[model samples]
Target: MRHARDFAVTVLVLGLLGVVAGVLWSLLAPRPPYVMTGEGPFLADPSTQALIADDGWFAVVTGAIGLACGAVGYSLSRRGRPLAVVLGLAAGGLLASYLATLVGGAVNLAPASITASGKAVSVFPGPLALTAHGVMYAWPTLAVGLFFALEGIAGYRDSPLRTPFGGQDPYGPLSSYDISDR
Candidate 1:
């Protein structure tokens, strides 16, 4: 029952964090500048770097959030089953990434193109969007990776083979050198 509760709480908290990630991505993601003309909107500068940067920002923010979630999840589930915790992290990370994309895109909705008067060019900010959809995987991937890494570290720390003096041997206390002499 306790494990179930922990899982539920983990999922819920991560879902909420996803919303926050979305807001953060919206704020941090760069807005590409577009020139609005009668024909359509075009990049103000020849470079599309800003558009790529926006995606990078989204990945960074969400990936950071995922790492936090992994650490937090591991800490919280120390007394519970790790498998349950990992599953929760995976599910939550996926949900969070999707939410971040949706909310960020919605929050940064592009304005309708304004008709430029005569030779005047109207500059507008483009909508926040993920040019590389694969970037979304960063969240879940980092989350799981972090969780496993921390788990391995903790396991290593508590391992019996990690003797303080390195004097103990796992094979019936007989060091390999001693056995070879016999």
Candidate 2:
């Protein structure tokens, strides 16, 4: 169990570093359609246009929820380590970002439909390489957050769910290092 705690702490620390690095990287090198890409704003089809508009709202709402999640994560993790606050917040951020992956799947979504200036277009959100971003970054973020949460709930402690976790000698293994002079 102590080993697990150590491992979890290491992961949380790495996750904190990741949050700092990711924010820096995002700021220093933002991707498109945010930046000036060769291909301008996607003149989406009608269906896609409507999808983007609706999904834009989804982004806003999800972002708000993500903020709330980060707050919750930070507050909860303070029970453990001060730095672990990062672990929880990072988790919420990753969880929110991952929802981007599920946005299409979680909801029965259709792309935005737009009929403007005689140009009917459909626009769906999520830029290219979104999957890569989620996999590479989100995984670590959620892992550390979950670890902190695990510690908070005492699930990492002794119980029937994890009898072998506490530091103790198993009856069979104790004979290996018995140094008594009985």
Choose the strongest candidate by lDDT: 1
Q: Which ten contiguous residues of candidate 1 have the minimum total lDDT?
A: 168-177
RMSD (CA, Å), each prediction: 4.3, 14.2
Give TM-scores for every candidate, taking all chains together and pairing residue i with residue i: 0.79, 0.32
Evaluated against the true structure, the overall lDDT of model 1 is 0.82
lDDT of 2: 0.44
Q: Which ranges in model 1 have alpha carbons more than 4 Å from their true place? A: 109-118, 163-166, 169-182
**Per-residue lDDT for 2-84 in model 2, tens only?**
43553365445444544443343333221222212257555333333443443343344344444444445455554655454
lDDT of each: 0.82, 0.44
Model 1, TM vs. native: 0.79
Question: Per-residue error at 135 for model 1, in Å?
Answer: 1.2
